[model samples]
Target: MMLKDKMRQLGRRDFLRYSAAGAGALMAPGLVRPARAETAGLTMHTWSAAVDTVQSHLSAFTAETGIPVNYGNSPWAQYREGMVAKFVGGAPLDAMWVSDSWLPEWAEAGWIAPVDEFDSLMKYNAEAEDFCTQSMTYGGRQYGLTYYTDYMAFLYDEAKLKEAGFDAPPSSWDELVEQSRVMKEKGIAEYPMMLAMAQESWLIEFISTLVYSHGGRLVDDSGSAVMQDSKEGAVEALQWVVDAVDKHKIVSPACVETGELAGLKSFAAGNHAFAMVAKYRLRMLNDPAQSQIAGNVKQAMMPQGANGSHATVGWMRFHGMSTQAAQDKARAENTAKLIEWFGGKSDGAYTFQKLLFLDIGAGFGVKPLFEDPEIRAAYDSYGDVNMIQAQQALARKKDTITPWFGEWNDTNGSAWQSAILGNVDAAGAVKKSADLWNELKDSY
Candidate 1:
């Protein structure tokens, strides 16, 4: 029978068998290696950083447990689409890397298995708890395991700030504006800020931080869209970005056409004085091969809002088992073991640090790793003044966990982008976005 025809006839048990068979075929060559004996053969789909961190450490895992790892790497944008297709097509996959943002959608679609069954194999890290509450939870049940976390912060050129006569970073938005104005007048920098307004994801991130810092929620307790247009604070936040571009003139004109990486490149090249960027970019700025401001970079919390509150964006990446594999149970167990071993201390947080530097996701998922003096000093080399402060900011930030319905990104993120890019007025954008959000909530 054809694959699709077979899929229609198989029961869950048979489907599991078929899925594992396909996965086994994919790993047949690698299975001959003695190290894979314990796993009964498992395959994983992950992004590049996982290859660098976890996959690179597979030999160690084999030495300890005798289970070999079969891993594949894909780009971030393709990982989700690939998994969704496989799940819906009834193809077997043992486990794959996923984004926390995808949990609601995938869980609701019944595309993933709950990781709670493997709780005994996993040790809870406080950092993992923080990620769980913000990224992996849906209606109080955990759907996946998170191994990485990230967020955006204000990155600046220390030399430029000092030349502009500022001894410390700005404490509030008003100070940021003032500092930017001075830097502009002094010609210390051509543009005071480098933001990726053109990149939709980055734009959403930038606006989300502003909205939360101003005491706004992307969606209310009822899971209905409420903040963007209805809240005064939300409107003001958008207006702040508008003013930065039009009135303050502190933002680069290139922001209109800049992609996320370009914004980082601009800041690192010293073409701009400051940037609102992911914390991991700090490492890039310190790499002399990639940065002109290698020794002059510094990191500070996102500036406080009108209410004296500062908010940051919490981004996370997760791993989940695919229902499509032949050896479903063995695959799930082996994948769990991999996560626990790599993220656990016995591996020495090697995967965690590599994730941060590679920008695979945020590494703060392991909190104790941040507390390590050696780690902190290395991050400090990139101007992470008191690493704990960045961690604290991430902890305090509002992480609005929207239901991971497939349409959530299309509805909410697109609407917010419309407002940020001037495609829709603030009220119009919010109303349209909220309408779509409420529709999704009602369906739920």
Candidate 2:
């Protein structure tokens, strides 16, 4: 059966039981190597993204290093559960892609091994974005190198703003409401703001961006839930969103049903004057072939809240080594090379990062990449180089990531959505989220 079906059969409780049992077995001494040929080299796995580009890169790695590789991929939605099954089942694996949210759980579960001893890999941290390095590190040990990273960004339809007689995007949240009201009154747009508030994976990132930009946090450094504090940024930030949707009527009620991709499509179609979306979408929005608002789409700093700065939330996925691969010295060496080849330097430069960015508009974690003339030129074509760099410098990682994040996030997303729908007050929504966060943390 497929991994998803297996997960369904096992259920969440059973899946945790399975992972717990697997953890015990993984921790035992004398791990047997998979029954692959000694000369077969490495087995790499990834989600089915940029397949042609990844295959081309893999072919180049083999041609240059003379290392045979067996690469395979599954759909992204199924990848996490599939990887867990593989980890528990001891499938042949060397390097694989890992999302940041899974780091704590995977690390604690012994599914992935840290690469702190590898100086070649460690050297990249000096050049990487702080959060990318931080996100890869868990329990004080760095796991692997970053595959890609991006931040949520505030974007606007320039033509719509201009038609509404605005010279520039709003600098503050209140200003945004004022400008949106003007755009609405002018008939530039019925719903002048676009916010995808659906209960999905993207919801947390959206929530974090709003909270961070408003100078609020869901949790503090002690890992205690502070989202319930009205003095903190959460309540105010959420209240702004609530007012925007109900009182201002600037954001469509349909936002509760919108997913990130759908919101991107709507923004690209020029149906909304302003939007909060992933920074990478700017490339797609500016592509004439894909977007109706191409050339008229522009990026702006995340609007500030009364007490917040222009901070936004950032996230990353990385190439991590399997505990199975790390157990053997030779295999560990080869696995690190493969990871470094893709995540670090390939052919004496950040060839893969550049290629990935040029091919699909993905962001890189390395600081030097921003200085590359070609990368600069490409970004300049679709965005302001200064603004892009400026906003990225202000990005922070999500504060709620923990071993229990997956369980808590579902409740958190639902709580925020309830508030947005006016089913609960903002304070009540935050309290509900905070309660679950504290409960989960205490259990941990």
Candidate 3:
């Protein structure tokens, strides 16, 4: 949720606005190799600072395998295009971070190399494997290793909810709206809900999550944008977003411009009561250095839809080898060794779960790590209830990557914002969006 760096419609303009939210907050690397020999081997690419901070860990890999590493990073906006060009041009990068959304096209185009040979190296746990199998398997081949995962949940103020006469978070849409009403009336919070209604990638995350919650989906089994076609589900889902912003006048009008940072700050400052946010964002929300609401905030599942939306609408980022790297035997071996060490290979026991996942809120896709008794006891434990409950909640309802997502995102974003702003009706906008989605597929 922090590093949007979106490579879609509403493209580069708003891309940088939210990507760096958790930058520089990662703990210092702890690679006690004591041998810092420099070799010009292994170039890894990622846009986020969280990955950047872990560069020193390469020393540990180098110590273990004697392979010196070069860490390369680009501005989030250019990382995708830059890497795509590198892949097409055969400019070798041993390993690089790849979004789940980008894997389909890259793998289809043969830009990324299959990692089936290194399968044993990639397994941290079942969840990690599941993420890779789900995302990296583009066309009968697995091309990447998942390192980071982001998922959504509802983060609400316990004190604020209590003041509103509710001891627990709302479970359904009606309950949420009524909770907001009481919170507003009781002066617990003027706007109890803050969503990323802006036109950037934040909008995509929020829109899709809400859409999924209403039993609507953006794409069908055939990888077509079908939300516009599911009128009962999509329209109602979008109308709730509109009603929350305008008709009910519960959320601030500024929500139209608000992205993740704005919402996080607002919720942190106690200006709002609930934020439909990614579990990773708790790094900021519960940080003493970053939030006034830290320690006071608690999590709940997103308010349910009429049909009950169970999925969190997630995006899992993985690391993949360039086909260029795969062609060279020596480079390929070095790359695999480097990836196994850096991309979350455990030390038999004592997996670096907290180091990799909790510190930056993005790390090892290991389900067992999150459920680890020790891990739960040490950090994720929030009294009786642990946090893995929220993290596991992040699941996507549909594959977001398609030739049409950019257009779909652009059209869906515009239509939804228009409806929310009262310039168009939700029903009409969604109907048009569905038609446009079909047109986009044909154009492709």
Candidate 4:
């Protein structure tokens, strides 16, 4: 059945439920404490990626500032849904994690308030990557301080490339296809390119990376949908994936069912010669204990398309103040201090950002952290620092981030998946996606 038809049959709510289920393997929701009394110091919420590290930092913040924190987290898959529930139920919240894509929606709903008045937080913009600062801003006002930021990156097994008689990674998508074919024919690998195209939270990032690298924009500068344009649009990008699966057979048909975490495990098992993944995964990919292909994995610029540069999509999560917390003068002040502590500096250092990078290989927004010997040495251990910096220089923020993003991403992802699965052509898929985008924009 067609994607739109299937979604209609299942209903939008059921489709989202199904999509959420696909990410369940990554993590289960953790217990979130009920909203604390107003007399309590502060309350914070985050997705369950770096719980231990965040708790440790929170502990230190409390020790130094005498501000007790009630911290909690849910799995990333359910984070947005859970946060919305909390907002509607009037749950007490002070500071919380917010994705860049959710900024317009949350701000418009009055769930999150601007932090532009906090000079302590604003001062760090001078030292942050432009992408980080820009992502944290919405509609002329800055909403939060960056918790973490990273771009999608193309990666490959250097050992596999060499074994396939190639000296370096592909610079273009066509070259990648040629390399994958040789690897498959030589029995070096089967389905040599790993892509997680599943309709989950990670789906939009993956799609955006492809679209941007292919020199296409889902939405133009004037905030209009252009993804269906015959030239320089999302069709060119989606067509590449469809061709990769159906024509070249370099990527598995099962990719539509694979989420990012599962694809990571598959690549780490040395089952694929090339993959597109989050830049931070390099740390896990090169860890001998976690990855069988350790020390062989290498980062490369995202392969370009015919009219494209090597650009890829970048995203950020920030520490945002809850509207409830911002209404109270003292609470807002304390929350800003907490935000500065975690997102900017802690005890005269980029402590949390540095710790986050060192702990899980997550990227930081702070540019000065790149110069730190400790951080430099750590990147050298698992990756090429020069290559990492070069690729980051090419990172671009997703253009489709708007108030209607959450609703449109669902349709866009499903449409792309349909094309990949051969249920629709690339033109049909992108047309469907662009149509919805335009409808959403008009309504907004």
Candidate 5:
């Protein structure tokens, strides 16, 4: 039976439940109590599993400082928008997770506070702190803190490849095209890939990876938008998205409807062959209770460009304070302390890394944890490749992202989506994306 057939194979559990292990821990009442009754609770914005991981470590903050933290999370694809909406509406936000690419715009707009403003905050090791920080700083004021870091790699089922008569995974985009065609012809996959296209920014993650993999620059040093009309490899990257749907038909028709979560679930359900793997995805892929493909899928280095080179995005999901923090110095101080606890070498964040990274065979940005014996053992699958790839990717990551990333995607990514859906031709889509992106760049 086909992998898609297995999702409805009757005896198998529902595909919706395939990745349930990644769900956030229950937000229990009184998980944290303020040391003083008068202390105001802080509202933090984050994504679901990430929030659960943080929630697990938050008791230390509550017990020591008496700061009560209330968690608010949106779907990962919509998180930046949710943060922006909160900031725009003047809603209460003490500290929240913001991506590196989105930080500059927020900081420029005065939507977030500098982490340096907090007193008694924990200090980060120079190395670990750098994983996601290079993109978040603006005007010399530090505005973000990252506890866990990751990268974009490939995840595939060795078993599925064997079923399709392959012994090794594709190492280049050209090979990926052929391999995916074979998988479809062999009935091993109905859709050769589960491409993310529904959410604009989420779609950009996949596109940016392809751009980098093809040795293309998505932007320049000044953080300007450069991909649309450039002779850079980005054109080939965007063209591939169009071809994936229109010509090769290697991607699912549902690409226009799938977001990250659904794409991940379909992969876990054994319906798709390749996925753009992030650090935390190791958890979902290996959780037997949550993955039919558990133990069968593993991380592979990202495929190289047509030119035998590649580029990549860096991991930096930083917790940033809101401008509203200035309203109450005492509460802001308390919130700062919590954020400090996150970046510190102390046990709260270390514990978070152990669960989110080490235990799940994922990687993090913390320098100290890399020395731990157990942590190294947990990541034995990827070996030293992660360290090497990560550093190189870090150096190039800034070129592909800007503070206006969220806005640029809305303009450009939507056009790419139109191309995928056959509503517009590839050249028309690329032109539209460029024009819209340039407009956003000039305005913001």
Candidate 6:
């Protein structure tokens, strides 16, 4: 059945029910009073999961320091715009959820407090250090704290590939194209891979990975726009997608209308042999109730570029304290204690284990979680695929962890989407994106 047809059969209540079931796995015990309310009047702005996670660990924090959390839960979209408005209006929150992409804008606006001031608040492991330093720092000052990190990688259906006579996965971009072609020819799958190109977020994912894989940098040291508009490497990388849809015909037709969630669903349903997905999709693929290819699903690092670089896009969400919030040294200390109790080594390990069991995706920022025997064992069952992906990501020479400007989402994102949709040639699309980026750069 067409994905669109399947989606039309799904009612809104069905999606809500699915979400409820998913959340049930992570739901915490009801809120209980701390022994002492050290931070009696502090409020925080974040998404619902953070609130739940924080609440789950509140008891430990209370035992350490009595800080009653006045937690606020808002959707990510609202948090960014609403928090900015509140901060600009002089009604800043004590702390809020901040993603890596928002760092430049928020840091430049001076709305967030320096993380160094909260040194005693939390501690990060070495794995966190290996992630990305620029994510939390700006102007030589740390402005945010990260609890989780996410990246885009390829998820594959191991059983389906074996059926197609492949004992191993593709190692390079050329190999991916060749294998995808063979997968289609053998009737192994309608489309071997599902690429998320419908929404702006997915478009960014596609472009960021392609650019990085091809030894292309989106911005220079001084934050100037720098993409190759007429390079063979860039053209070759872009052509891979063009051929996937237009030539090899290995991508679903619904790709134009499918969003991130829908693409994940298509892959989980065993309609595609592989998918370009966020770390979180691991969970969906493991849920026997939701996935047809349960044990068959495995993850692999993205294919290498012509230059032999293994580049993938890293996306992270961070936490930041508000500058306008009244500073209560005692309350801040208690909040820090709470963050540490939930996001520190022990909690991070727990989160990683849960993620592995649920296959929801990879843990956000903590790398040490991989060292856990159970975690490593779970991934090992998939035949070292996860390890290879991680190693490739680590081996990549450059990382595009710079803060994205507002115009980036509005302009560059749109142009990339246009190219993916076949509305513009690759060179034309990149040149347009570069021009828009330069314009945004000058305005800043």
For every candidate, C-alpha RMSD to the true structure in Å = 8.9, 8.7, 12.9, 12.3, 13.5, 12.6
Clashing pairs in 3: none
**Native-vs-model 6 lDDT?**
0.65
What range of 10 consecutive residues in model 6 has the weakest lDDT sum?
392-401
Sort all candidates by lDDT, best to worst: 2, 4, 3, 5, 1, 6
lDDT of 4 at 106: 97
Mind giving the per-residue lDDT tens digits that candidate 1 earns over 1-444?
Answer: 799987688899988998999898878996545433444556666776646566656667778778755777777767777777767876445667777767767777777666666774344535454644456666666555565667777778889999999999886777888999999999988788887766455666676777766656677656656665545356667667667776888876457578788888888888877888877777888789989998888777777777636666677676666544323666667767765664444455545444444444345565556666766666676665475355444543234455534565556556655665668776776677667767767776
TM-score of each: 0.81, 0.91, 0.83, 0.89, 0.76, 0.80
| Stronger candidate by TM-score (2 vs 5) | 2
lDDT of each model, Cα atoms only? 0.67, 0.92, 0.70, 0.91, 0.69, 0.65
Best by lDDT: 2
How many residue-pair clashes does candidate 5 contain? 2
**TM-score rank, highest first?**
2, 4, 3, 1, 6, 5
The backbone clash count of each candidate, in order, is 14, 1, 0, 0, 2, 9
> For model 4, how big is the CA root-mean-square deviation?
12.3
In candidate 2, what are the lDDT values of residues 1-444, reduced to their tens digit?
899987678778887898998997888766544556554889999999888989999999899888888999999999999999999898889999999999999999999999989998999999999999988988899999989999999999999888989899998999999999999899889998999998889999999999998999989988899999997899998999899999999999898899999999998888899999999999999999999999988899999998899999999999999998999999999899999999999878998888999999999999999999999999999999889999999999888888999999999888988999999999999999999999988998
In candidate 5, position 85 carries an lDDT of 82
Which residue ranges in model 6 land beyond 4 Å of their true spot? Answer: 1-39, 121-127, 229-235, 325-335, 345-362, 377-404
lDDT (Cα, tens digit) per residue for candidate 3, span 309-355: 66567667776787767888888877776666655563553233346
lDDT winner between 2 and 5, please give it. Answer: 2
- Screening candidate 6 with a backbone cut-off below 3 angstroms (N, C-alpha, C), the clashing residue pairs are 38-66, 148-364, 149-364, 149-365, 279-361, 280-360, 282-359, 283-359, 283-360
**What is candidate 6's lDDT per residue for 1-444, written digit by digit as tens?**
999999999999999999897787557444333323344455666765644445555544555455555666777656678777777776535667677667777878777766666555335634464444456777777765565666676678999889888898887777877888888888888789888777555666676776666656566767666664545345556666777787778876567678888888888888888887875666668668889998887777777777736667676666677665426665556555544554453443445224423343445456555566776676565436355346435532123334446556667666655776789987777778777777766766
Which runs in model 5 stand beyond 4 Å of their true positions?
A: 1-56, 65-93, 117-125, 129-131, 324-336, 347-349, 355-363, 377-403
Candidate maximizing TM-score: 2
For the record, the alpha-carbon RMSD of candidate 1 to the native fold, in angstroms, is 8.9
Residue 190, candidate 5: Cα error in Å is 3.6
